[model samples]
Target: MPGIHITDIEAAINFWRERRPSADGFTLALPVQALASLYARMVFQRQDLADEQAFSAAAWAAWQTWYASTPDTPCIAICSTSQGDAVCKGCGRTESEVQYWPEMGPAEKRSTWRRITAEGTAWRFNRYAERARETQRSNAGNS
Candidate 1:
């Protein structure tokens, strides 16, 4: 998951599975709809590149905005991936949410991100946090 982190990816996949299994398979996987939106955004932002620097820059900018948000994750604490059953008790996301996350269009992706971020209020730091921490720690160690 380039645009999103692994935990978020797992959470999202689990979220979607609660509603229904994908037509193709029961186990949900990556390559969701939103990744395309990320690619498109990267291209649009002129940050699209196979290089590490491009990825670092894009990831940093994205993370900074999301992580600093007061609310973060907008999750109502009703996770769908719980063992009891499919479908989140709190959020309405389901298998489709997982399947569609990577391929969603820009508008759709933005909407999803907004919801996930709770309109810049809530932020979930899974991948970005790890990355930021590692970078800072490494930098400190180096300095």
Candidate 2:
């Protein structure tokens, strides 16, 4: 439910168009490409996806390689928002962002991630850089 975005679908379509183009103007793989295209159309045309689960699965398949390399959450097992900080000193998210994180779409999450990293005020961003890298490496190895 909280997976790929329309931008991701568009990127995949572009990649396929450039790297795996077909002579007949159809993608080399119709099913997944068509699914992603449908999702992109739904998003850009301001329509809801008819089947979110199916679309998520198809988008995951289409974007799995990129997904694997994406950064993990910025949380460092500490949350200052719960301790009454409006902007979390632990991870740099606002209280509202922390409260609504699970419901956030990929694009929203990425935007928050960018802001936190750029601000570099959170303990997780500044003091825990090595810890974050270690955790990422550990998670990647496990995967």
Candidate 3:
């Protein structure tokens, strides 16, 4: 069940839109249209995932384009799974995920990204986030 998540679909749509905005404002680029078609169908069927094997050639090409533009890994440099934690506090990845990430397929990696983002409890989303915000506030106060 290797599939693109709906959020990834939305990202792909945005990517295509930015790369090939409608010239006439009333039409879509072919890549956008192809991905959008799949997006619409997924929405109509209430599916959150687009089956990789089911993608049309055009849609597949479009998705690949978008996928290539994205970061390959979610690592934020900090790792906690190295210290016996089941999940890395930084990236929200399990120890196994950290260890095996380099060998994971695209879909598998994306799936992990989707899960971590949805959970939104990782240090990348919180601890580091708070630190960044504090720095921003401190800088603003200094200014």
**Better model by lDDT: candidate 1 vs candidate 2:** 2
Candidate 2: where are CA atoms >4 Å away?
1-61, 68-72, 130-143
- Give per-residue CA lDDT, model 2, range 4-108, as digits (tens): 445555656666556556777654565347656676567778754233354555555656544444665777778988889899888999999989888976656
- Can you write out model 3's per-residue Cα lDDT over 13-61, one digit (the tens) per residue? 8998998999999799999998889989999999998788767899889
* TM-score, cand. 2 vs. native: 0.48
Model 3 TM-score on a 0 to 1 scale: 0.87
Per-residue alpha-carbon lDDT of candidate 1 for residues 1-143, written as tens digits (9 for 90 to 100): 13343333334334434444566874332333333334455556765232323334544444333334323222455455464435433444454553465675333443455455553322133544456688999999999
| Highest-scoring model, lDDT | 3
The candidate that wins on TM-score is: 3
For model 2 the local lDDT of residue 89 reads 86
The backbone clash count of each candidate, in order, is 23, 0, 0
Q: Give stretches of model 3 more than 4 Å off.
A: 135-143
TM-score per model over all chains: 0.28, 0.48, 0.87
